[model samples]
Every structure is written in structure tokens, then in C-alpha cells.
Target: MGRQLATALLRASSLEPRHINISTRRPETLGGLFLDQRWVSAVLYSLLNMCTAQKLGAGKTLRLLNGLFETNTFTYHSLVNSPSASDLNSPDDLFPWMSLVDAQTKDTPLTDLVLRDKGLRDCFSVMYYNVFSNLAEG
Candidate 1:
């Protein structure tokens, strides 16, 4: 689960690598979180470490995300395994946002600050992955 969070965080392309901070000491380390790709982040809440998840609250979590996204509304949908074009074209109040596009479509894409991360991991996760990957590749 910790690795999953790290993976999710590293996926945020818009975020400067220095902004993220994560633990380097662990079973998996931060290399498991791969960035430098166009793939979307897909983090399963169930996969998160129990202790880490326990420290989070739904409202608090939302607030934290909003802070990152820098918007009251931070929505992210995975591009790799996204819904069908028909489903996306369907009329709905809830718009699934994408991270790369910025057009005025019926549905708004999740290309903003916080929602940019497909997996939506915290800053710590992204930072750790950045540092770890650099060390590993170097």
C-alpha cells in the first residue's frame, strides 16, 4: 500500500519533483513508484497500508487534495483504463477530469493542480519516488 501511494504520487507530472517527500527506508523503497511516463495513476484505497489509511479522514483527505490541486474541486480519472467514449459523452453533472487536456468540453478534464495526479498520492509519496528513482537510475 505504501508503494501504491508512492506510485500514485510520482505520477503527478505537473508537480515539481522537489515538492514531494516520502520515506526512503522500507521493504519496497520508492523505486516501485515510477514516473517519467504518460500513464495515469491508479491507486487502490484498499491497497493502502492500514496505518496510513487510518491516519486519514474523508473530509480531511478531500481538503488536503484540494490544497494540492489548488481548487475546491479536484477530480481525477485514469486515462489508461478510462470509460468508453459513449460513457464519457453521456450527459452527466459529474464530469470526469483528465490531466492533459484543457478544452471547454461538456465534461471538464482533470488537468488542474491537485487532480493532475492520476493516483492522487500526497506530496510525500511523490518526493520519495523522485529521490529514489534518481538514486536507482544514477
Candidate 2:
């Protein structure tokens, strides 16, 4: 699932695989713990909600998922006029406070720390910075 989504995002040009942090158990590997671990039910439920037919207004969440999997871009502003406040994922999910593709920003120091690791730094796409800035004011 992670590979497919990452490929889709890369294919869409929304984010390159080198620009998306997937974490690692072994050096030089792109995806490791992200796919290997169990996600907290809450975060999984939320993501599942986004995948399901309803929950988000006008089915935008599902659309976002689809866009992430098969479109040229996620089209954040066009699909969702107002992105809801992001919920924090459990520590088990990694980067719990980092928003998805929504054009909202929040602090996730732990996430930042992980992303800044020697191997993972520079892995997240520019679009990620555009939406989720690491700057204190962003």
C-alpha cells in the first residue's frame, strides 16, 4: 500500500520518492518501519475514514486519497475550501501531528527530528514544505 501510494505520488509529480520520508530499519532503504509497523486504530480509523465513502464533506477525503493514488496533484485548495484541524496520530504511526496533503501546517518536532535524520533529510518533497512548513511561524 505504501509503495503504491508513493509510486502514485511520484507519478503524479506531487512528490518524488526521494522527497517523501518513509523511514528505515536498514540503511539506504527508502521504506521500512512505515509499512512494517502497526498503526494505532485511531489513526488507521481516520485514514480509513478518508478512504471510505463519507465522513469528510462532499467525499473530499476520499477524493484526496484517490488523488494521492492516481492524479496529477492532490488539489488541496480546490477540493477542500477549508481543511479541518488535523488530529495527531499516535506515536506508533510516526509524525502524528503532520498533516496529510491539506494546506495546513502544524508543529511536529518529533516528526521533524525523524525527518531530519542523516539518511532521511532532503527526502520530503517541496510540496510538503509548501503545505507543512517547518519554520516556527509556518
Per lDDT, the best of the predicted structures is 1
Clashing pairs in 1: 20-127, 21-124, 69-114, 97-109, 97-110, 98-109, 98-110
Off by over 4 Å in 1: 1-39, 44-52, 68-138
Assess candidate 1 and give its lDDT. Answer: 0.38
Model 1: per-residue Cα lDDT over 1-138, one tens digit each: 334444454553345446644454652653455432222222222211221344543345444445643445532232212453234442232222322432222232322322454454344345545555554543
Model 2 per-residue lDDT tens digits across residues 1-138: 344433333443454444554332333353422311112112222343344323343235535544543433222222222332232122122212223432123323323333334332233332233222222122
Global lDDT for candidate 2?
0.32
User: When superposed on Cα atoms, how far off is each prediction in RMSD?
Assistant: 12.3, 15.0
TM-score, candidate 2, is 0.22
- At residue 85, give the lDDT of candidate 2: 20
Clashes of 1: 7
